[model samples]
Target: MKRTIPPLLTAAALAAGCGTVSTSASSGGGEDAVTVESCGRDVTVDGVPERVVSMHPSLTELLVQLGVGDRVVAQAQDALGEPSPELAAEVDAITSISADVPPTREDLLAQSPDFVISGTEYEFSAEQGFAGYEDLEKAGAPAYVATAGCIDRRSEGAVADTFTDLENLGRIFGVEDRASELVTQAEQDLAEIEEIIGDDDPVRAVQVYVEGGKLYAIGGAVEIDVLRLGGGENLFAGDSRFDDFFAAEVNPEVVVDLQPDAFVFAVNDAAHEEQTRAYLEQTLADTPAVRNGLLVAVDNTYVQPGTLSAITGARIVAEALHG
Candidate 1:
């Protein structure tokens, strides 16, 4: 069953003056000479981007992390609006592309952005009817897609590949130093976690993202990497992407067959936490995870692919499994 959860409202306030971006050059070289890959295409950014637009929240967060939030002139519709207290102030100056739609070409062109950043190809596809990078080329604006979410699988090496993309972004944004530091920190964090958990005994676990009473199983290399990093085994070893499974497909009898020792619930709001917990308790009462009370709740944001997966995500899972 697939349940649609309402869009989450962020309590964070938008940063003041996000809408009045200035084209004046900074003290240093503008992002004009910078070049970044967008949807597998190389885009040359002439100078430091004076006017920028971001299509995804994850990409927006990445820009901020790189210390270039002030360069952003506009943002996508759902991408704007504060989602958390930490991000509230940054979102203030941004203009919404539309009530609920991604930024249109006219909206983007009006902003006069030198470059645009997106976390995935879906952002471009959903916003522009154009097939690929051609639309961005025609618009005279460079676009970049975070490579973390573009992997063929979510395996350990794939996870490392995603991390490499973060480094690539840092290089493009003139923050190569910071990006390297972050990658080093993330690697150390993962190593420390693995050391603490040790390879002695791995726990069998399954990630269950519940929204609107529907249960979806996450597969692929990325999901598996997360489970392994937490020192757990993924119950579903399929080749399909993350997909939904109905009650019948889940098969009550399969619970015993898979024998997951724990269940991870990904949710957006606190209200649904208890509701999902109760539903899972009732539905899988006979399962080992339920009997042992190993149900855990995680932020939906972290579970989604992006830079946070290497930073906040690793910490969240480490604390859950070890602390």
Candidate 2:
């Protein structure tokens, strides 16, 4: 799936300042020039990007939410979930550069994007043959890494941290007003969730994922914060083993030993949900969660960091735990 770097973005092209970047920001009143710290790097966008490449579904959804869906010329093809009704048309309009896989460097360079955004630093891995920041920079595109995706910043991630992405994108696209309104709405929603879970002891839960006959427990990630927002606490929060890993394999014996009140798990579809529940029921039959039928299933995308649906996820978790 790897392709050689396109000749169009070679040293010669870079020397001549050749690329598809627009020279002006949007007509709306926003800073013509904006700089933000993105994944330990200071990235500056010369003007609002008119042609953007979004490397993750969550970030693409965020762009559509910011009212800039028309500017997205290309997007990653791996969809964790279906687009919301509000975003369906826009999501359908953008061309997908890869299918359920990371887009390659040449694939990205061919688009001549004015800007590029990804949910994680992994999208820009040079070793994996994906376009790196320097590659995008050579094409006159500024790369933006979501704050929630930054490894160093995620240890204490909160659902509110989504605000930073919204605000930063607002400034980048001259849609500050739209961003502000969304933030206000999200805050109000979170407040309501808090009110619902008030004065209740937190639910001790473990967020589990089963893949390829292996079991993993989510730890040291924003998923933990989402769990906390819903009045639940992850048993593996701050576990040194997951300080850098999002989720890791665990012995089934550990789940039996911990005796959590509930199991918050992710599922891809209805059939998968049924299968996961049956597996958990059999594997951990004696655990309180299985015995009490306290397993809560969440959509794959909702639990991802910095997603707007994460608010909905927190509410779902709260309802499952408190009610």
List RMSD in Å for every model shown. 8.6, 7.8
TM-score, per-candidate, Cα-based: 0.73, 0.86
Residue pair clashes in candidate 2 = none
Point out the worst 10-residue segment of candidate 1 by lDDT. 9-18
Which parts of model 2 have CA positions greater than 4 angstroms off? 1-31
In model 1, state the lDDT of residue 126: 25
Q: Assess the local accuracy of residue 245 in candidate 1 as a C-alpha lDDT between 0 and 100.
A: 15
Q: Give one digit per residue, the lDDT tens place, for model 2 in 1-323.
A: 32232110111222223332222212222346788777667778878899999885667788898889899999884444455557767886788897555688999999999899876566676656778777888788888877877645555556677899898899989999999999999999999999889899998899887655667787855677788888997888767767555566789998789899899987655765788898899898888899899999876656665678778778889999996
Candidate 1 per-residue C-alpha lDDT over 1-323 given as tens digits, one digit per residue, 9 for 90 to 100: 12222222110011111121112221223535665553345567665667788765545666676688888777674422224447656755566564334555556667766677754444455223322344555555666655644322222223565565676667667788887776787788778777767654667777665545655554533445666677667777653332321111244455556678887655555766788798779877888888998887765444444544434554556566666
Q: Pick the candidate with the highest lDDT.
A: 2
* Best candidate (score: TM-score): 2
